[model samples]
Target: MTTNIDIIKSSGEKVKFSLKKLSASLRKSGADEQTINEIIEKVKEELYNGISTKEIYNRAFALLKKKGGYLASKYKLKKAIYELGPTGYPFERFISAILKYSGYDTQVGEIMQGECVRHEIDVVAEKNGETTLIECKFHTEQGRNCNVKIPLYIASRFKDVKAHWDSKQHETKLEAGWVVTNTRFTKDAIQYGNCIGLYLLSWDYPKDNGLRNRIDRLGLYPITVSTLLTNREKQFLLSRDVVLCRDLIDDLFFLDHLGISETRKSKIQNEIAMLCKH
Candidate 1:
């Protein structure tokens, strides 16, 4: 099949599929050119008009997993982020961990007083004496983009919280508000965020400075990305606020508590070590 084959994006927009983009993504997963070409050839055989990116990804991921679970874990990082859901709290913790590793002091699930009310912020990140009230939009399913209404609501809430902070004579000042998500933001949402000076972060926003980019650059793959760990074990780790695989390296007691055998535990450690090397 040619690149002309129409494919549906997660946002429900139809676009021509590009093999080059697919190759680049596979390469980022550390797949060699021969393996990438083979996977592309297999994927091309399954191509059809109106196929969703999700299906294409599943096919590619299954093929990659068969080759090696470690590489497949990197290839399926986006879906692993989705697996942090069913509730947004795990995602909040995940985001907080990302910030913490990036040299920011972060607090998750904070209930603080706004100018006129109390607000439960998803994450409050501080660095360089500037605090940012970050609200996260976590979506479990694909294709759910954050639209203008989300930023609109966040902007107003940010204004209220910032007002409270600015009114105080404090050492750290509330500098900006951020709206982050595990998915993409609509055009209008991004435009609105820019116009109001609110920082917006999502799966692929702000070009190379997005959440995925940060996670990859910092080797902050979520523990859910571990192919060796079962869902129950992953959830157990999440309950203990262990989000990143890098963090799991330091917290092997969770595995010990779950009665993971030494053979399997060593293998899991090996996989995490490879992934965290970035």
Candidate 2:
């Protein structure tokens, strides 16, 4: 069998199937080495030229469910986030909730003045006098990277904000400028952010504090992860400002308001509770 096979990505581009990358993703989802190898073999056997990554992901997820349900659920996280929006607002709000859970008071879509210009920050996190200005880049499609230009543009904005506040008398103690995205960052983006002391958060970037790690740590799965909610249902919830799994836990009535059947509502609540359990 040929090792090279073209697979269509979510960005409508075709790329070579990567066994090592698949293994890495499974390992990150807490799969044991044996399971990872088994899944890889299964996926390799199923691969063909022009197969989509979505197809590969579904196959892997289904196999994971058979091997271990919890791992399968965990594996759904990145895709769940992608389901958060065609627009990034829902993602920003979701990130705000995560920060709030982590002890940072957060605000989404705050307008602030910089030294040189006015900037609309996505999420502002404040904890114990330390403030972090966050920019969220959300993509509904896979294989779309947060490229170097993003960090460059954001860094410039941060400098403006930092310089402005440093000259103000209101005692704003700014800690960092952060860029968080649901997708991966390009190599150049990571390198540029690190060189300038900018905080770059993306899916599986930093070993301990990547966006995925943070979500896992907080048990903050998005509402899109629930199998009870169909894609249209999830989109409806998103339209109504219901984004997080934790949101469902807090207000089961929200589900009821959406006209979800009582039986289905109970099932969804149980699923959300398990997935978002701290």
Instruction: Point out where model 1 deviates above 4 Å.
Output: none
- In terms of TM-score, how similar is model 1 to the real structure? 0.96
True-vs-predicted CA distance for residue 202, candidate 2, Å: 0.4
lDDT per residue as tens, model 2, 1-278:
52589988887887888888888888867799999988888888888999998899999999988873457767888888988877899999888988888899899999989998999999999998888999998988787899999999999999999898888775458979999999989899999999999988888889778888898888888888766678888888888878788887777666777788889777777777777765
Task: Please provide, for model 1 over 1-278, each residue's C-alpha lDDT reduced to its tens digit, 9 standing for 90 to 100.
Answer: 57689999987899999998899889988899999999999999999999999899999999998997588999988989999989999999888989988889999899988899999999999999989899999998888999999999999999998888888887898989999999999999999999999999999889999987898899999998888999999999888888889877877888899999999999999999999996
TM for every model, in the order presented, reads 0.96, 0.86
Worst 10 residues of 2 by lDDT: 65-74
